[model samples]
Target: MKDTVLNILVDLTGSDEVKKDLDVNLFETGLLDSMGTVQLLLELESECGVDAPVSEFERSEWDTPNKIIAKVEAMTNEL
Candidate 1:
């Protein structure tokens, strides 16, 4: 799941330099813009089989790889 999310973020950001263990701020790293967040949510839904609610879309949620995995795990558990 972490790999999937990381791949999506990398694709969305159009960067291959993002390290798996690096703590990245989506906005700070310019990895995601406003619209990119929506695209990411859609990708997460499709790839993770979990629908990410707008309410669940938060800065903290996209703060880092660990957070993303946690969020996806939570969303999967909710399913």
Candidate 2:
């Protein structure tokens, strides 16, 4: 799950550094913007079976790679 989320983030951010730093603030670094977040949610749903709605997305909760992975894991577990 961690690897899958990281790959999505890396592809979204276009940075290999996302894989290197789990705690990196994707928003602050300008790696991920609002547009990227929407795309991330789509990828998460399609690739990992995580069906989190856009309305549930919160930047504070999903800023880092680890957090995003955790979110995906939590959402998937709910199913």
State which candidate has the highest TM-score: 2
Model 2 per-residue lDDT tens digits across residues 11-75: 99988999999999999999999999999989998999888788899899989898888888888
Which sections of candidate 2 miss by over 4 Å? none
Tens-digit lDDT string for candidate 1 (1-79): 7789888888988886555545777688777788888988899989999898778788866777667778888889888
The 10-residue segment of model 2 with minimum total lDDT is 68-77
Clashes in each model (backbone N, CA, C under 3 Å)? 0, 0
| Every model's TM-score | 0.84, 0.96
Predictions in order: lDDT: 0.80, 0.90
State residue 36's C-alpha deviation in candidate 1, in Å: 0.9
